[model samples]
Target: MINGPNFVKGFRVTKVKEFSLTKPKPRTIPVPQKIPTQKPHQPVPESTYRSPKEQEVLQGKKLTNRQKAEELLIEANMEQFKCANPEKSEKTKRVLSEIMREEDNKMAFNKVKVQHAPMKVDNVPVRLNAAAILRERALYQRQVEEELSRIEKLVDGARDPSEFLEWQRQMHARDLEKQLADIECRRLEGKLSREEALLARQNLIQENKKKALIKKEETEKLMRVYAEKRLQEEKEMRDLVEQVSEGHKNTKQARMKLQKYKQQIVQEVAEESRELLRQALEEAQEELRKKFELIREIRAMESVPFIRQTLVDLTQTAGHGLNCEMSIVELRERLALLKEAERKAEEEKRDQILEEKQLKQQHLLDTLEQISLHRAAQAKAAVLRLEEKKSKSQLGKAAIANNDRVTELQRKLEEKMTERKRQAEALKLNAQRSTSKSCKNSYEEKHWKELEESRERQAQLLQYGVVSGETANRMAAYQAARNGTSQAYVMPS
Candidate 1:
């Protein structure tokens, strides 16, 4: 390294660090990424505009600007299918599809485009990703690990194979031969011809001298450039600091002016409000004084005779006299009459109250009587229902018993018919033994007696439920009875 000259004050030489212009090898070890355990709390942003096609398809889905633009292009292309037959418009569809594909390609390129950070006054600062970066970093690390694992497995597998090992061994054997050749040359050193040694020294001296001169020139040029750049940066920083101080001063002045103006406005409003309140108070006091003065004037005029006296005097006594309080006798007479009228009014009021009380009592009695009557009617109705039920049951039993009696009577009548036949034969013999006139009279008399007995049996049978009681049939039977003969009715078989 070369030192600076002593003539320059405060300009000591510094050994600058050497920086290689070639790019550095990328790091192999991956940094561990932290996985998030919870969802992000921040809200996502949405686009303000959308295409009609997306509006129809998305329903409620939010879209980005790029997505909306893509949908709009697709919608325009699809409209051709509606206006023309798909078969006829195949060429048009193909052209639209081509246009759509190009737009999609452009959009895809923009989506993957690399974005560079804006440059600062000092330098372009590197941007740090939020939590999403950790996830991406983890994914990248996983891919790298997979590749490394694959390579390791391939190498490990190749090392075991006999053919692969033979190839590697061949390559290593060539390298070993070169190393042996180098060792032999080192062992054969320290012995050279006189002319050969002198020529090698001369060549070495010339090469070193040329390299040292070139290195010195290059170092000087690099140092000059570094010093100029540093000075320019220092000047810019100082200017920026001065500008910040000036801005602060201007802000302070503006704040003072704003505060002063606010105070003036507040004072003006307070003064105006106070002035309005004072004016209202003065008007109220003036109105109160005017009202008091009017009252005072009215009182002073009341003592005048004309103001006190009036033509339309409305004070009148119930007596014939014009004065009401002329003497005690007149007053006493009027008071007695008023007392009599008050007594009569009191009596009338008492009568009205007593009449109202009597009417209330009568209404209460009437309601109580009606309620009692209703309850009695309900009890009677319940008793009647029970009686009807008992009567129906009894009637049912009687009808059943009467039906059995009728069956027994029918059986007995059949037996009686046989006995009557034998009796009739005996009667016929007795009649034949008598004279012809006597026989005829006896037969007629005996027939009438049998008819009367049959009528009585029929009436009894009706009471026993063997026959029905009908008014019209009863009338015919009564007419037959009055004529002293039996009337036969043909019963349906």
Candidate 2:
């Protein structure tokens, strides 16, 4: 049976081979050889190409099929070739079709079948066990709930979250919630990642806003402090200005007072200098007076000595006979005469002084008389005017009163008149005595006569042409004559 099976199996295999060989092979279409087509230098115009709407529908289509018939003909330069060789036109067309088919096949073969890498899930650090994930989610939920509660309390109280005393606790809770949300979202299918990122960004933006608010409040506080400080400084400056003004006023007053004091001191010094100068001048005048007095005393002493010596010389020169005796007597008489002459000279000087005193007294009397007359006239005028103003009754009483006062004034006037008359009489007597006394003394007269006699004798001697003896006798005779004449002229008293 095994052999029979083997023979059958072998017969089937041979029959399969005979059929495979005997069956006519299907005709295989020959693949065309590729000929490179020259690409156009310029892009085809939009009008000659498929519209965008059509291109979308015909995406991945052949450019030859999509191009206008005229564009294809122009690109291929088929018109010129057809015109030149009409017989080869169909063959060229077939060749071109075969070339285009070959190009299409090459493009199809070059096309990459890009299977996108299987969409990968990012490996998060979080464990993927459901129980652990759920437990962590619950914990994050509790934290979020706590953060929510704190934020709600802050909002209700109108307090800033950033300023909260427990702000760190809130921040930790928010971080936990954010991590949990990120992990959970990543684990979920079809979750929008953009939403998760946006939520985190929004939280960060809120934190930045809180920081900015704090900074703004601090800036406002600083500005307020600066303004108050500036106000205080300005006030101080104003006060200082006022103080300076007051000090300036005081300084001005003090300067004025100092100037006045300086002026007064200068005046005092000037006055003292003037007074000292006056005292020095007075002292100089007193010293000059003393020197003048001393000079007068010296002159008087000198005159006394000269006069005594002259008297002694005159006495010694005369001699002793009758003639000598006469000469002696004459000399004695001359000495007596000299004594009288000296007495007369003194009397004449005294008379001259008396005359001058009388003249001065007379002048004083005249001036007094004139003054009295003027006063009398004034009194008369006053009396007349007083009488005119008086009433009849008053006039009577006034007349009595005036009579008594007038009597008193008249008594005084009479007394003054009597004194004046007495003084005038005394002055007249003294003047008379002085003139008579001056005439009676005759010393100066005698001296002048002697000198004249001497001159006349000399002239006489000259006229006579006398010898010495004759001259002596003539002189003696002349002297005797002169003495006789002088004796005759002498006063009898």
Candidate 3:
């Protein structure tokens, strides 16, 4: 790089060279001035008395600057004039000089004045001046004069002025006389004031007192009539009460009689029901017994050889002849007979079985006795042999034979004992079986009897219209008596 002093020296010299100026030569020439040309004026058309349409356009049209300035000056002048005298802006005074000039405008303005004159004057001050007062007073004087003249004419019957003038003087005197009469009447009225008012008040008070007396008399008469009417009503009420009490007593007695009749009817109904129930129960029992007898008869006939056909032929022949209205007691007796027959039949069967068993037992006993006797004989034989053996001890062969025979006899006795034990066991078993069967039969019979009693009682209760509880209790008692059993009874609450 160059030294700082040298760099500065070169930069300064170049600056002066770049900015160096040369001397100038002068030459003279005049500068021209430009003047703006003014636009030519176009005159506005003169304002003519236009129709309403033309006038509206002229009034609403925009104005040139000059016309605007002129209008502003005119408005300023008018405003200054209004400020100088505010009263002048009020109802404009009529100027005779202006009216006399401009004939058409004056005539138009007068016509407007004639139209608005009353309204304008109405707004003016109404000062009561001498002229107005005089005019009013003159009008009053004229009206009075006309009245006076008419009155004179009427008094005189005048059709002419001469007669009227003569009547005018006379009427003046008559008016004076009338005025004096009115004054006299007013004086008389003033003098009578207190006496007249007192008389009027007395009349009014008398009329009021008479009205009050009449009203009181009428009220007292009405009260007397009302009291008499009330007394009559009380007498009627007392008579009615006595009649009602007598009727009530009769009704009460009748009701009691009716209640007694109802009780009698109820008792009759209960008795009838009980009779009907007994009859129905009897009838049902008879029917059941008859049916059972018929069944037994059929069974018995069937059991007999060829007897069913015989019975059928007999029934066909006798059915129409038989009595249908058999009583329950008769049927029950018949059923009992049948039951006895059946029991006899069962007893006969039992007896037959017992006879058979006894015969068998007797036969077995005979056999056992024979066997015991045989065993005894064998023992006797053995005993005899022993005796013989003892007696003949030297005969040895015979003694040995007797000993063997005693052993054989002992075996035969043991076999017979076993046979007797077996027979006893068989008899015991047969007896036990017979006893159990008899017990079962007895229990079934008892149960059937209880059921039959219950059914009979139910029928009785149904016919009587009594409750089942009472019927059931009676049935239980009846069953207990019949079956030789005890019964518990429960009462209803």
Candidate 4:
């Protein structure tokens, strides 16, 4: 059986033979036997060609949807072409069909299957010449006029006019719908603009919040740094104080001495001891200077950037919104200087007033002293004159003289005595007049003073919120009435 299968397989293999004709001949392509010569140009018959538009449609790359519509119109024109010039339409139809087939093949590649469905041709918009287009338009308008005339005749004769009226109503509804659509469009546009504005505002608010948060963090950091620096300055001041008080820090004796000095400061005030008070004040001032010196040294050690940062911090924290013309510190210093100048001016004015008062007082004291001295000189002169008179009277009786000479001398002496008595009386009268005038003036001055005091008392009462004028008059009237009644009753009839 195996030999039988081998025999059959060998017979099949023997029968199978490769054909020589299936192999391609390895020979070069032969050149033309005769030299090709250019043929003479011959004019093509005009009957073989189509119109320019039909040629363009045939030569176009492919028919897009818009091209397809144009193609359909052009195809429909083929029939019009037959009716107008019947001789050429068959050849044009052949050209148009070939162009359409190529376009359909191209579209089939995009659509997954070839659709050989014939597109219904629309009427060709005959636009080759303006004159022809006008003729066609006039014909179409005439047809429309005839149709409208026929409708009007029917509407006039028929009882029912619902169809025409219904068309008019539909047109009005369309116009109304167009207006409503325009209004809705405007409303939507307004809404869109408002929404955009709201979104922009929200974005701005978020940005502001972010900026505020960052500013808050920066301020907190600056405050922390400032607090640390201030604490360091306070610590430095404390150290300086410790150094200044070191001398008094040693023993019981030194502490006692310092304590005693401080105690003496209080007693110094009671004793009016300016020297002790001044010494204590000078020591306090020295300590204060030491503190300020430490502060200055610390400040001087800081960099310019640190100082500028502190200045910026002060400006922002104080909400000064300072400009670059000057610093906040400069403004404060200027204000302080102005205040100090005003205070100095006020003090100078006060001092000037005090000096004037002191000068007046001194002048009054000098005048009083001069008056007393003048009075003392006058009294002394009077006493000396009296003593001289007494001495002369005692000596006159002891001296011897001739009777006539004595009488003449005595008469001259008596005349002199009369002159002295007359002079003394005149002085007495002058003194009395002066005293009386002074007394009269004193009385007038006292009366004026009392009047002024009464006026001042009334002013004070008014100033202290007392009811005046009408109330006072009423009270006075009531008192007057009571007093008059009492006096009348008490009087004897």
- Best lDDT among the predictions, by candidate number: 1
The candidate scoring highest on TM-score is 4
Stretches > 4 Å off in candidate 1: 1-254, 302-381, 387-493
Model 1: weakest 10-residue lDDT segment is 186-195
lDDT of 2 by residue, 1-493 (tens): 6556453233433344344677788999999989999986997688766567766644443433445545867887754432122245567899999999999898996798887443333454655454554454456557669889988888788567555747885566556555544443343311233334434565576588689989999999999999999999999999999999887766877899999999999999999999999999999999999999999999998877443344434434345434445444457887998999999999999999999989866765555555456557669999987876464435344444444443554455455446545655665686698789888778668866785676566656556754354555556566657566432231111
Q: Tell me the TM-score of model 1.
A: 0.16
Q: Distance (Å) between predicted and true CA of 315, model 2?
A: 99
Residue pairs with clashing backbones, model 3:
none
Residue-level lDDT of model 3, residues 183-289, one tens digit each, is 44444343344334434565576588689989999999999999999999999999999999888866877899999999999999999999999999999999999
lDDT of 1 by residue, 342-409 (tens): 99999999999999989866665555555456557669989998997686556544544455434554
Tens digits of per-residue lDDT, candidate 4, 1-493, equal 6556453244443576788898987999889799789999899978667576765664563455458878889988764531122344577999999999999898885776556555444665545344544454456557669879878888889455688897996676556555544544454444444444544665576588679989999999999999999999999999999887986666778778999899988896777777778889999999999999999998878844543343244333354565555556777888999999999999999999999989866665555555456557669999998997676545443332322444554455456446545655665686699799999999878766654464455456656767575554454445446444221121111
Error at 364, model 1, angstroms = 15
**For residue 195, what is the lDDT in candidate 2?**
34
Residue-level lDDT for 489 in candidate 3:
47
Task: Give all TM-scores, in the order shown.
Answer: 0.16, 0.16, 0.16, 0.17
Model 2 CA deviation exceeding 4 Å by range: 1-403, 441-493
Instruction: Decide which is better by TM-score, 2 or 4.
Output: 4
